[model samples]
Target: MPRNQWKPFQSITVQWISLLLVCLVALPVANASEPKATDIVVRAKSKDAKFIGSSMGGAMVRIRDAESGEILAEGLTEGSTGNTDLIMQQPHRRHQSIAEGAAAFRTSLMLSEPVFVTVEVLAPYIKKQARVAAQTQVWLVPGKHLDGEGLVVEIPGLVVDVLSPQTHRYTQMADAPFPIRANVVMMCGCPISEGGLWDGSQMEVAALVKKDGRDFATIPLALEDVNTFGGELQPDGPGLYQLLVYAYDPRTGNTGVDQVSFIVR
Candidate 1:
């Protein structure tokens, strides 16, 4: 994740408290070289939102008019020194400006030989979720048509350690009239090695519910005795139900939630 575009998720409750959500941030970055004279550089390293560093190795930075797509500001490095930095004349005011400059730079490549320029975007926050599924196999009737016994839910955009095994398996007892069992598997991007570092120690699941294309409910769920982050719903006897999984990041107090649907007989 680009530094500027990266952010921890935080939860918020609406006035109705029907659905839960988190903030989303977007950031954008670069390409390679051509004529030293026409080339521009957008720095990737920084502490603040704006690009506030000196340019090195004859590199230059340019800020263009957002609407007209005209060059409004420019900064160029003085020599071949690799460590040198070139600060932009005017700091980028918003994400749109960076996007505009990126577009202009890309356009330049088609007209003339490609001049490699790097562009980056900074935003507020991003959201991510953990994956969920039945840990064990539940009994399914042959052709008698009983409700499906297994449930699987996946969360997208999650970061995992990637070095160790990334599979999780567990089982949950079905509640009430359903009278069966559920197995869940959580596949996280973070590998097993990284799992111990997490505050939750284990990833849990939750549902992001919607109805008729509008937000409706967010339910925390769990398996067996473990509070995986969701609750079981009583079946209406038949039809489809949306199931989701969520991961809580204790470090940033952020939560990621995603969903799928299931049918009950």
Candidate 2:
């Protein structure tokens, strides 16, 4: 073949190869911008399930089955700030926000069998209500520990109202080894007996008991030794008992007492 005839054919073949190369390289870059449906990350045994962000602004998430696309669970990770960092106790699926309006989905797989959970975080346009802090001032009537099984008191709910502190009172009563009913009392901003020490000249602790809605007896206790606040109930009686505690500190005069009621079996 002549050299001029071969040159023209070679040029045409080279042009065709260059076009094919451009097609292969440009396809991947276009696919990179598309949103992904699945993101799998393997967690260690000790790590907790948490959102990968912090202070997410009203972010919401949902979990779904990968193969079936059935929704399983969901939660909101929006904090006061705009980052979605949260700790989930169980395993599930998660969808996160890529932009303010658009979203990108991600999946989390747990290696630990016990703590398997998936959570989806979403972003809502409107703001949500703020959570209230728990009120420590409202205390159980009888305090924390009890000698018998029936007498126990705890804060009632998850959210304690500050404006209405009285709503948080909760009591637990059950059959006990002994016939005693314990009660709780508190005095704030004033000297109260703690650490087993009380001033002999300062105060007097009093408990007035009533049975069947009738006044029974008033027992006065020396502030120096008034630690236990429970009393033995009559084994034969089936009525309810009421207990009221009053404090008299000479420096602060007489402070009022709180009334608590319990039943006897």
Quote each prediction's TM-score: 0.28, 0.26
Taking every candidate in turn, the Cα RMSD to the unseen true structure, in Å, is 29.7, 19.9
lDDT tens digits by residue: candidate 2, 134-163? 111111111222111111111111110111
Estimate every model's Cα lDDT from 0 to 1: 0.29, 0.34
**Number of backbone collisions per candidate:** 29, 22
lDDT of 1: 0.29
lDDT of 1 at 217: 64
Q: State the weakest 10-residue window (summed lDDT) of model 1.
A: 160-169
Among these predicted structures, which one has the highest lDDT? 2
What's the C-alpha lDDT at position 153 in model 2? 13
